[model samples]
Target: MADNRFEVPEYFKCPLSLEIMDDPVFLCTGSGHSFERNWLQKALDRNPFQDPITNIRYGDRLTFGPNRSLKAAIEDWKQKTNYHSASAQRPPSPPHRIPEPPRRPFGPFTPSLFPQPQFTPPPVLFAPSFFPPREPVAPPRRPRRHFIPCSPNRLPEHLLSRWEWLR
Candidate 1:
């Protein structure tokens, strides 16, 4: 058995980096099985491409890397691909970029993306008649106060004196 090291085949090596491949592997229409991502990544990591922004490895197939020119790479790809009707078609529109709020606002804050108020129009406001007048609440009655008199003649003298002294 040969070395099992994660070595890619020579053909798979990216010209820019001349190393083993990394991410997405693109097959160029001009040359089948032209580019490999792992090789591109290794090449890019070791020594960034001269263009930096874009790196077009194979004929029409472009392996995008940081710093390389996107527009140039795309144009090159377009040329190499021969502008095949179906392949040349514009890519699908990306999903809506809904702006999410950093965090829910405490009160009265609305999201800009969705301008309309979330709350539905207060379900047609019903007249006071909608609800029966709360059973008429009777005015709370005031508690009655009464006074008890302690007559000096009715009390025993010592006891009354003690009571008076205690008071």
Candidate 2:
């Protein structure tokens, strides 16, 4: 694995968003095109028989299906990144190396890559628990009864922690 962080596999990217695919779907149009479900649906509504990127016409009959394997891979990637982000105590492992799944010459689509001996659920932190049970919330800035208009407050661009300044 490379020393660089935020590295994502090429196949994991969504054609429409140009970002890592959140929910992959097989448009099954020309070349059996794949995209994020919402993105494809939006594009399909506009042009049912044509691919957005290639402009290749797939004819009138359009079909779409979920890319379960790709979706699972994406979710797994998300979990790993999130876990790495939250666990400051745990030393960062080497960058994740996702095993490549099978793919066509032009179309890169496959099912299982991280084939576990058996299915295993993600960790507890991947659940709704963001902060620890004992971690106290920061004090609210505004009074409950007061309404301040045009509060020129902006949220931190990245995770805000006391440790950020140390780096």
Candidate 3:
């Protein structure tokens, strides 16, 4: 069967994957082109650091900040058009299971044949009395020091003479 692709907006689609951007981000280049974060990261990892759209080298330090405006616009477009991704529309595959072998039934059902095991509750690890409650103790207060304020104009005669000599 031929795969039917959904008609996604060119701007909304990532340049690298050519699919709708799940987490769009700016390429941090002058062009300011946006691409899916994961796809861009994979491309950068495999190839040299550069802008996929413009094919411009960005050197070692390549940053891609989240394009919130573009993301919002894409979300708005999806809502307006009631668009769903191909992956989302595709039904999940059924899980694989090992088929059990058919068993022959016994002549008659008997409780004596298969005795039910008795269940015993586990012992409590922690008891209320194990930890006794105590009154909360307040933290120790630090000693306070009183400051003596002295104005530059109120200097003593001896200190003023020494200050002048130093100057």
What's the TM-score of every candidate structure?
0.18, 0.43, 0.49
> lDDT per residue, candidate 3, 22-135, as tens digits?
899987666878889999898777665766767778667677789999989888877877888888899998999999965666555633545768899999999978998988
- Best-first order by TM-score: 3, 2, 1
User: How do these models rank on lDDT, best leading?
Assistant: 3, 2, 1
The 10-residue segment of model 1 with minimum total lDDT is: 49-58
Model 3 vs truth, CA RMSD: 18.5
Clashes per prediction?
13, 0, 0
Reference-based lDDT, each prediction: 0.48, 0.70, 0.78
lDDT winner, 1 or 3: 3
Model 2 ranges off by over 4 Å: 1-3, 30-32, 83-167
* Model 3 bad stretches (over 4 Å): 1-6, 93-167
Off by over 4 Å in 1: 1-7, 36-167
Give per-residue lDDT, candidate 2, residue 100: 100
**Candidate with maximal TM-score:** 3
**Candidate with more favorable, higher TM-score: 1 or 3:** 3
Model 2 per-residue lDDT tens digits across residues 110-139: 545555487788767665576568877898
